[model samples]
Every structure is written in structure tokens, then in C-alpha cells.
Target: MTASVVLKFPVFTVTEFRPLDRQIPKNHPSNSVKTYLPLKTPRFPRQVKARTTLMEAAQSGSSVNTSTNASMKLLFVEMGVGYDQHGQDITAAAMRACRDAISSNSIPAFRRGSIPGVTFGQMKLQIKLGVPHSLQQSLDIRRVKSVFPYGEIVKFEVVDGGMICSSGVLVEEMGDKNDDCYIVNAAVYVGY
Candidate 1:
């Protein structure tokens, strides 16, 4: 019978276990790396537009409502963010994107921040389907907008995927990369 041993590190001696059946192949290319991973991300800000009724209504002529929107900032902490091979977590990177959104929105920093009990900040959201080649989805037309517990957001859209633009959302930064969506930190202007 094999006996279980209780040992503490620094006190007990340890040895590396080498696999007897396998060894690194001699002919393997130096740069060749193998790993089980998902698809490579396309790009930040995805260089796409998520058009909705709002965007269309804004651009429409005559009877359509012509509204102007101001920018704002909001803080965010994403749980999932990472690279497929390197195990890179994109949470901080996504948060950085959210922080960048603040200045991009043209709203005062403090205005987008919370004042404790007073409640003066934008709420977080989960990105459903990212904007694609057109404003509408391939199958259905969805009116995409950042939802806030407070109220409706005037004007907001995807900026970049964290590659080229600043104010945008990244699903990799939302939840585990394995998930389809992630948490989104948005900037909303209230009292306007």
C-alpha cells in the first residue's frame, strides 16, 4: 500500500518529476508553440458601428428628433480579460479602456464618478453582440444602448476594441474569455 506523507515546504526535500514516456521532440521548430486556445480576437473598437434606432433617428431629417449628446466617464473592473495562449487577463486592460472613455466623453471626471450615497455615476452593462459591419445585426435589428438603473443615456456608441480607439467595449474584458459577453463600464451624462 502506498502511504500518504505530510510534508512542509522549506523543511522537506523536493524533487522534480520527469515523465518517463515523453520528451521534447528534437525536430520541433524553435518558434513553434502549441496550445489549446479559442480564436484570435479581431481588433479593438472592432472598427464597426452598432447602429440603432437612436443613431438613425438622430441622423433622420425633418420630423425626426435632433438631439446633441455630451460625453462622460465611468470606472470599471472587469472579471474576464485575457489572451488565448499567454493566459493574459484583459480585465485591467478593459478598465483602462473604460477610464479612457471618461476623457473621450468630454465630461468632467468628477461628474461621471459617484459621490457615495448621492449616486452620481454611470452604471455598468454587459455587451450582448458587438457592433458589426452595419449598424444592424445580421439576423435581427437590435436597438443597442447602454442601460442604466438611473435612466436613459442620450448618446453613446462603440469607439474601439482597445486597439485604435479609446471609448469602446471589449467582451474579453467582460467575463471569462470563454464567455460570449463581459461587463461594460460606460460614461453617462446626467442632469443634462
Candidate 2:
């Protein structure tokens, strides 16, 4: 038979047991072990309002003035990176990356309060792409530009970069099929 004893501390309580064959005093150091655990709180993000500014038309020649012949200086930047597996399509991977970058952001930069007389279609988008050397020529610029629906002046610039990994697999069981993996990087700039 065994007997159990309970010990109380300022932070925690402990329960210990001993065999009936041994008689050890409760005050002994080996008889009890005390432990204390701390609880942690979680953190969250806070939203902040976007800043606004008013400037003369001569200072910024790109925007058209609406009220008082003055222009509103509006600027916003958001960036993201993405990856695609199995599809050796460079353009498709780049499009996915671009989509990932802008998908989470909701920017109404053309509103009258920010940029007066500036419409959504007037905004210029510069899309820079980094692709593998082997797939540089295969990347379709037209398809890349199609990713942006509202920008008036959307341009795509492809540079020699990114990586290619060997998948050790063939497509359709063909000997000449492309079995290597392809990666593409994208950076989209939105402004007037």
C-alpha cells in the first residue's frame, strides 16, 4: 500500500506519493518538486487611416485637377511573392505572383478626396518580372499584362533571374517532355 500527500505553494500545488515500506519526512527536499507556469497573451494588428495631401498641378504634371484647379497627391504601395508547382509555365507563375501581391489590397486611389479628377483607368502599373534564363523567351508579355484589369498603362519588363529545379519526372510519358521546374518573380508598381 502507498500513501499520498498534498503540498500547497503560493503559485502552485503539488501532490506526492510514497511507498509504505519507506518513511520519508515531508520537509525533505527530495520529497517534493515545485513548478510554476506563466500564461502568454496573443497580439493583433491595428488599422491606420491613409494619409492625404493637396498639391498644385504644375508640381505633378500627371494628375488632372478637379476643384480649385488643384491636384490631390495619392500614392500606395503593396508587395507579395508567390510560387507555383507542376506547371512549367513561366507566364502563369508570374501572373500568380502578381495576383498574390495585389489580391489582398483594396486601394481606391482614384477617389475625389485623394486624387481629384483621376479615374481608376488613368492609373499606371509597371510590372517587373524575373524569370529563368531558359524560359525568358517563352514568357508571354501579353499574358502578363492581362493580369491587371484596370490600369491604363500596364507594362511588363522581364529580366534574367529566378531558378529551375529538376523534378525527375516526365510529362505524358514523353521522352522530350520538359521535366524541369520553373520559377518566376514579380514586382508590381502602382501609381499615377
**Could you tell me every candidate's TM-score relative to the true structure?**
0.20, 0.53
Q: Say which candidate scores most in lDDT.
A: 2
* TM-score (C-alpha) between model 2 and the true structure: 0.53
Report the backbone clash tally of model 1.
11
Q: Note the Cα lDDT for every prediction shown.
A: 0.34, 0.65
lDDT of 2: 0.65
lDDT of 2 at 52: 36
In candidate 2, where is summed lDDT lowest over 10 consecutive residues? Answer: 65-74
What is the per-residue lDDT of model 2 for residues 45-153, given as tens digits with 9 covering 90 to 100?
A: 8777763343343355556443221222335444555444555777777778778778988766565446776776577766777788778888777877777767654
* Clashes by residue pair, model 2: none
Error of 2 at 38 (Å): 36
